[model samples]
Target chain A: MYPRAFDYLVPRTREEALEVLAERGSEVKVLAGGQSLIPMMKLRFASPTTLVDINRLPGLDAIDAVNGHVRIQALVRHNDIIRSDVVRAENHLMTSTAPWVADPLVRNRGTVCGSVAHHDPEGDWASVMLALGAEVVAESRDGGTRVIPIEDFLVDMFTTALEPTELLTEIRVPRYERGGGNYQKLERKVGDYATVGVATHLELDEAGVITKAGIALTSVYVRNLKVTEAEALLVGRAPSAELFGEAAAIAAAACDPTSDIRGSAEYKRNIVRVFTERSLAESASIAQGS
Target chain B: MEINVTVNGTPHTADVEPRMLLVDFIRSTIGLTGTHIGCDTTSCGVCTVLVDGTPMKTCTMFAVQADGRSLTTVEGLKRNGELHPIQAAFKEAHGLQCGFCTPAMMLVGSALIEENPDPSEEEVRWAISGNLCRCTGYMNIVKAIQLAAQNSTTGGTAE
Candidate 1:
């Protein structure tokens, strides 16, 4: 399949990109990794009038450790995040979850910020960002920026809260000390989108009591599902198999999955339950050592 | 639109439509058919190519996106009229049957061994996870990559 013909604009600077976006607004689509947008265009699911190519823009690809947070620029690809020692050191969940996003080839070009902006229900980065309480920074033509929390950024399937003239510039993920995290996914085959995926992050106090807990589910909801009630159950409580089971049950109950070729709703809920338990157990074991 | 790209060590300039995919540009415009487009849906890695030393699915990227970048396709795997080590290994190991997926397999294998000279069996599987081989069931392909890693003195010379 071929993409529909569209005017392509290469912006060497972020300022140029913002100008193009502001002028074109709803008619323009920002091309970052081109992993998701290209496919949609080829399938004719999306036909934008103009494509503002930001891949050439410099100074937007760094993964830096800033003030108690790891700031990832919009241009930083998935493979870059996987290879970044700073990211791995700060949030091990990202490293473990990135490989599950897509194959190595796709990861070489797919950007985390782009995936988060695309807002696919099965996007691993979206679930991970929710589990980590990440924040997204969007820039506009007027040089104004808004930092939107991950929860507020994702609105619905293949939709985000980003304005028409706004471009995602950076993603800030808070750094946590003595944390243990795991991402568990069940897919039909390698490189396939997740059938059910769970991302869990836990921080233990000096006494091995859960001080912070974040849990999110993917591929089982209209949007990335965060089990805040389950997370609250974990905090201030000691790690135990029974407690993890309860949290897993809560996550399974919270998810609203539709039956498709992958599995039935009940089957996916069961997978979510099992994966959540396994991920929580693994995270708890690591938290004890951390 | 015009694009200047370095493919197979040769810099070429071409006037291509902005919507032209990199795989189509390489095959139809540059006349390098080694990179096959098995599935244009980006799920299949038959069109895998190295862009600036990184393996990328060319079908998902536009020709304009590849402007000013260097790309290495399967046609570049031969050095001085001889098969590259990875290609020779595939030949010796009988890693291919119909030869449809051979080019992408060899290219991805070369890139994988280049990154890790001593990759485990699991690592080899993970490296070529994107590229699919419907004929060989991947047993012989895995062996071919392992043989290439052992016999290769230098990594990924197809540059």
Candidate 2:
């Protein structure tokens, strides 16, 4: 199906794109990889009046480690993250989650920033970003740039803290000194959204005790569910199956999933509990190895 | 509204509406109908094409987005009337039954072999995971891709 008629703006630079966004506001949509936005437009679920194509804008595709964070630019595609040795080294959750974002075809064109900015609760990137304590960067013609914590950035389903006048330029994931992470997703088939997704990050100190922990859920809540209660419970403790099971129980209780064709609500919550425990166990092993 | 795209080694410039999808532009405007559109919502990868050598779903991408870019459709797999290795291997392995998804399957398979000359069966399956084939139960297709990968001496896209 063809999308509704709209004006297409090929912005040659970041400044030009921001100018159009600042002026057109909600009317103009920023087209990054077009993996999600274009499909939504074709379905008429989202029909913006104009699209500011940012693909031509140079220098927004780099993935770099800067200031103790890995900055993924606006144009960094999902496949780019999958192939990045830096991401593999710096953020294990991101690298582990990269291959599972859609498929190889979609990953070639879908941007990490676009997926995170789109903020679909079913999207795996946001949960991973949340698990890594990622930051979002927005820019406009008038306002310079604002850094938003991932928690505040994702306000609701397909909704974000971003103003209509602003464009999401980048996402910054903190570079941990020693951590291991894993993303466990349950999908019926390839290219399907996650039924129950769990992203776990465990950072251990020199003594192998947990220094920091991050656990987030996907497709189980109104938004990406960051299990702060579970995270807190693991921070002062060491990696153990029993401790992970306790945290997993808290995560299962925290999630709000409704019954659908995927499974009954009870089954989904059980999967959440099981997946949380499994992912945390895997993450702890990797952390101990590191 | 004019976009310049190189398809199948030929540069074509056209003035198209912004809503025109790349699949439509290739089939309708460029007159290359080998790339079929199965599910326009990007579910079935029958409309898969190479945008600057990376496989992407053309049905979800706009023609304007292909401006100043290169695309490789199924038609590009053949060079000088010779069938691409993947195409020949598909025939030998009986990889196709209905032939509705043949063009895309060949294109994706050829592209995968180009990237990894010796792709494992799992890698080949993962590479074509976006594409859905209702025929052959994917066993013969996997064999076809492995056949093509083993037979090719040089990394060939036949482009």
Local distance difference test scores for all models: 0.91, 0.90
Positional deviation of residue B146's Cα in model 1 after best superposition, in angstroms: 1.0
Per-residue alpha-carbon lDDT of candidate 1 for residues B1-159, written as tens digits (9 for 90 to 100): 999999999999999999999999999999999999888998989999999988999999999989999999998988999898998889888889888888888988989888998788899999888888878459989998888998786544322
Q: Looking at candidate 2, what is the lDDT of residue B153? A: 57
Q: Which ten residues in a row have the lowest lDDT in candidate 1 chain B?
A: B150-159
Q: Interface RMSD value for candidate 2, one decimal? A: 0.8
Tell me which residue pairs clash in candidate 1: none
Share of native C-alpha contacts between chains A and B (below 8 angstroms) recovered by candidate 1: 0.93
Local accuracy of candidate 2 as per-residue lDDT tens digits, A1-290: 87889989988888888888888998988899888899899889999999988888898989999999999999999989988988888877887898888988899889999998999999999999899898999998898899999999999999999998898989998888778999999999989999999999999999899999999999999999999999999997889999999999999999999899888899999999999999999998888777
RMSD of each: 2.0, 1.8
Please write out the lDDT profile of model 1 over residues A86-182, one tens digit for every residue: 8877787887898877898999999999999999998888999999899999999875999999999999988898998999999999888788898
TM-score for chain A in each prediction? 0.98, 0.98
Query: Mind sharing the TM-score for model 1?
Result: 0.97
Q: What is the lDDT of residue B115 in candidate 1?
A: 91
User: What global local distance difference test value does model 1 have?
Assistant: 0.91
**CAPRI class assigned to model 2:** high
